[model samples]
Target: MRPAIIRKPAEQSVTPNWDDSAAARAAFSWQAQAGELCGLPGGGLNLAYEAVDRHAQGRRRQHVALRLLDRNGGRCDISYARLSSLSNRFANVLKGLGVQPGERLFVLCGRGLELYLGVLGGLKLGCVVCPLFSAFGPEPIETRLRIGEGSVLLTSEALYRRKVAGIRERLPQLRQVLLYEDNGGAVDTPPGTLSLAQLLAEASDDFAITPTTADTPALLHFTSGTTGTPKGALHVHGAALTHLVTGKYALDLHPDDIYWCSADPGWVTGTSYGILAPLLLGVTSVVDSGEFDAERWYSILETQGVSVWYTAPTAIRMLMKAGAELARRHRFPRLRFIASVGEPLNPEAVWWGQDVLGLPIHDNWWQTETGGIMLANTLAMPIKPGSMGKPLPGVEAAIVSRDEQGGLILLGDETVGELALKQPWPALFRGYLGQEERYRRCFVGDWYLSGDLARRDADGYYWFVGRSDDVIKSAGHLIGPFEVESALLEHPAVAEAAVIGLPDALLGETVKAFVSLKSGIEPSAALHDELLGHGRKRLGAAVAPKALAFLPDLPRTRSGKLMRRLLKARELGLPEGDTSTLENPR
Candidate 1:
């Protein structure tokens, strides 16, 4: 409802990576970005070599690459030379176990020194590294391991006994299990499992990184759909360039700045930005192994002198609910830039940052399939609430509809259509592992259909509608759940909301919403009536939810996205398919 808030550089005159968008795009090329990273000692490219060895052999050898804080309130800093030596030890350990190049290796531990070393080490050995969420149940873990044909697993002794031991028999391809002490060596090692610490102790600290080209597979990230098997999004070593480019432009990382990305390594954002990007830039990356706590987070930003912070909207909303007064308790003078990903942040959150934190949260858009950021509201650009800003310099985006003849028809500004990208970007996922037919359906030709509906405004800002499957058709009106959810979030009492379409014989489908109130607010009939009236006022009657209900909390994925499809399935009593990824399936 308000005009776009034009951002002004502060009194100190903060300079961004690039000020001009058009000129930057014209000058951008994948070749030049790749040239930024020193390739292997020979002529090929390896992610670990570029991210670790290059920095280790250069002036940043003594500079802290990872500033780690464990859950038990312990602190440690690993420099580039230290990281290189440790990762080389890990690579030698893997080689001793006969883990071959191109073989799939899974890292299934919490955020710590081992998780970081395992990923970089696997890449150095030319093994395809996949990081699984530490909080995942046994089924999800087993599914990913089986689908990915995991050859080796790097985990903690406790996790190995509790989560992986029961499912290890199901995976014949998983020949080796390397375990470490996640909780300060409190748990004893189980039989048939090798100790990672002992292996590292026996292995040499120097090893040559395996020769790899740009197309050599380095990362395999699994993304689950609403139904069916999970898709393994495979990425090559060349994606480091995209990570480097996006990190500088979207996140605005500086050499002297201490950057923290709160996402876990289980996700793509964590691997690309949390690990490779920061290391590629030779910046110190702060890794917190602890869970989310508002006071703890505020303390980190203040004490660590974090200049750039990237996190998810779910954590941001929780911090917002804790109230701005709590944030005022700790001052973050060095926290210059903050950005959010994983969800389309509501307009209210964008304004909250400006009002409370003295800076607007720039929201960037990308997916697990894309491997890196595609569109973003850069620091130099004006803040448009709830809009995914212009495309990355080397990326091209469009809204298009398929014609009857199976050709693509590009739409004009303000017209909603399936979001598509002109492909062949460095980080573009090469395949979906085993599902060739399913991967083929995602593209008509060169345009990779995103399966989400969106519209581009005259100012080149793209607004998220809803996923193609999640869009609601009610009384001849196309309704995007995001619009209704955003409106409901504007209310003070509402903490979270999820919208879906339910069956209606008369109207075809009707808009319905489920809301979770703020911390102490209980469900009440009067409050329900008030929320319905508020929705009607914000969005006209036709687009507003015809029915509304209060829930303790809505279902969400580990990445903090609402599971709208699951909500609809429960409403209709249809078979809830593939509920493996739900944070609260109960």
Candidate 2:
């Protein structure tokens, strides 16, 4: 397929906030950009102080910071001044509980006012705030709590009973569990837990933000491994600089823009963008405390006047499955920008956004270790559908292969190799918790090995191939599963697809795809042959799937990422390690 270019109209194009490539290199190096982010008056820097308190004390105090939508179709607006007082009170509550600085504070609750207060408050108190998915089962919850050695946990009564109560006894380091009543603060607390509302009532609404250096750790995010325990990526307060820059240029955020990031705070994107980025940029963010519903999402986008939307590819594909006619029922006259992360966005989704949503879905790439957006299709640039655009101003990206001496050998453009970045970026993770050697192995001299296979086009756009481990070697050809999957999705009947490599005596490994069809489409022998022919026509016999299986649904993470590794493990009858993050574990 030819590259699909989505060009911005002259009137709609935004003037990028950051300096141009040449000017940026001359004026603002990574260190120079780091100096621009807000620091405390005395000396040190703090994430909460920069995100909330500063805005509260400034002219934007009356500006709405958060617009929270409840399940009952009600709304609550929180201003910077009000949020500042609330977070200050929550910080005071932490102090009253004898929770010291540098302690781990984990939040296991849905999106709500309390969740926001807890996160900002924990950061203000200098605690390492970690947010877990509310849907995680007991085992995953226990593993994170154990690894993080959580000193405090904030949750609702319902989540506590369903997920955390059974594992509470095993977490010896957990000092307290603060429960928020679900029934409008009318419920009684369980024997071992304390009431969060009552504590807040007793606490004063004034507390000083902790003075900390840019290097002080502020967040602990746990990322799943295919094997072994989850790795905890530690990030510092200085990451705010990366968040500010990326939010400004990549998302095209403006002070008057009303933005919505549909990612849950449990994941890294949710925390980095959903909470930190929008707030740091001083934009009004809409937060929905509900699950994925096509109608509800469109309603939020339409009614809230959301100008910029950052979401996942899975959610976008799900919306595509619902048909474009459903989206035509509403109008978003104010919406101007759409961006996707968490996984690579297929080319079809990008065109769908342009056709249905009146904009192209700009795809960006980053990782848990990177902590913020490293590469993106910024607002000022023309987007090549399915391409992760050029690296951000301060980010230096390269495609490199391993040398015989275990050092990195940079590859030229249009060559497929491991994607590596020259580090010292502000948002880079400090280290994996207690895994010094494991963390050190991620770097080769000055380059941080991304462990992703990609190629840079002659035009400078970066295209995602597949995970290094997911590359299939077949008949002297290295095939990326994403290419095969993208080809399969181009078929009209296909709704979702996952590709893997199966052992073959002749080719060493052959491509196999598991696909789910669109609604009202029946699986027939003719349709199967048609899909096979489509793949062959698009990708050729060397890279096309040799076999295809139809399924009702594909296993994905809660964050909407397809589990290709799990599919392969199940097909080969191998042990499926760490099924904790699987959306549907069977």
Candidate 3:
């Protein structure tokens, strides 16, 4: 099948000769296609085969592929040889259960050996895999099952009995349920359910992998929308090639580097960096299959000699709260790089990382549709504190001004406007699965509308402002919510905050803040004054919140991202649209 990404305008543009090394050049070369440079060829390869089988074929069979740490301090060191065999056996088990190629299969489990094997097995058989976060309740799970038309569910018996048992009646497409346990008793299989081990025992590991081309849809990643219902973003095999290029060049991943991405496999970050990127670079991936603790994470960095660490800004802030003395005592001798995603890192977080961890947390930016990191701070370049840095080589970005006439005018240096990509890279998603019209509208003229607002400096650095739809229009002043939110977070009493534009009698739309206070902090009229005063002092009176409401917690998605739209919906008493994307909505 021809690549569907070719339809994007970004895939039809001219590329510049960015002076890079031979390895970088070759990786970048694979990203170009259809008279445009976007993605690479996977050598007709499956990520599971490349990550496990290819590594095991050579003399380096004993090399450790995964280091899994359990909740009780137990550690399991898995070799590439064992991983290949286990994955192959599991693939046979899937086939025995009557699952076919081109079928949609869902895996709802935590980050462990079983989760990895299940995902790999499904891919090897040419089934599109949809991985959901284990933390999600039955509502979100059922929504995914219905939307995906899932044929089978690979989950723990405990979770099946608790979450899936009640919702099974709603999912008609679900034909079978497989448990990931050894204890096979007279437990209720719900008519068609079966045991995972029993099926594997009857099947053979000698089965051949199904032939899948680059254009075949490989993954169906549901974006955790902070506003509306989650949209499943479809990614193809060709997009995998771009993921390799991005991880290698943009993140500057090295083969010898022991990479640890602390993102859950449920989100896009997990798929892009945790699974695809590390495997493509042929690096040893460290997996901590347990809850995150500050000291434990630091210990992982010190004990494992992890060279590269990729995490979210929220995690960095949590570490900063633990104080720098603990970080000073930790010896991360092998750690050369640390990167942050999800949101642009605050200047304080960046400073704290450099001071405590001996490395600055380089901030990068991208969305679920973009596939991987489209903008990042390369190791060879100087680190900028708050900027998301320039566009990755082969990816084109611009800040275009939209006038009253709805014309998109490209903005010059130091000017703020809507951030849009001029070309589609290999990692770009084909379209929103089953939502063609909604996907088509995201592109304006020949560029993809990123919905983000940004400004480019004369030196080519792009600074993130906020989202276009979220921009606040007060009186005649246009304000980005991020600026005000960041200003409010700088205060000592504030743990987290969300700013939105509300209908006003005089100012047209006034800024309103819904804040979550820090521990031991009391929410009163005085604390409200203090928070607003802090914002006014830093961001000027124009962007300061006109009103403040104290909440115990902010509405967030299953992935721990704040959902400002939900708060807005509550404040206005408007009907909240599909909130399936949120873990806990107001």
What pairs collide in candidate 2?
none
Q: Write the per-residue lDDT of candidate 3 for residues 1-586, one digit (tens) a residue.
A: 1110111223212221232444653555442522221221334656566556666776657777788877667778887788778888888888877789889989887788777877888888888888888878899899888888898889877778778999999898999788865233434555567777667667666657777766777788887754456688888766766777777766667767788999988888987788777766667888887777988999999888898899987778767666677788789888877889987676666666776877777788999888888887666556667778777767779999777887789989988898899756666787787789989978877788888898988868788887777778987888877777777877777767788889989988999998877667789988878887877888788878888999987777655566777778888998777677665554
lDDT of 3 at 165: 90
Model 2: runs farther than 4 Å from truth? 9-14, 18-21, 24-26
lDDT of 1 by residue, 112-168 (tens): 999999999999999999999999889999999999999899999888888999988
**lDDT values of the candidates?**
0.90, 0.90, 0.76
lDDT of 2: 0.90
Candidate 1 residues lying further than 4 Å off, grouped into runs, are 11-13
TM-score for all models, in order of appearance? 0.98, 0.98, 0.89
The per-prediction tally of clashing pairs is 0, 0, 8
Tens-place lDDT per residue, model 2, 398-504, is: 99999899988999998999999998898999999989999999999889999999999997889999999899999999998888888898888999998999999
Task: Give me the overall lDDT of model 1.
Answer: 0.90
Least accurate stretch of 10 residues (summed lDDT) in model 2?
11-20
Q: Which structure is stronger by TM-score: 2 or 3?
A: 2
Candidate structures ordered by lDDT, highest first = 1, 2, 3
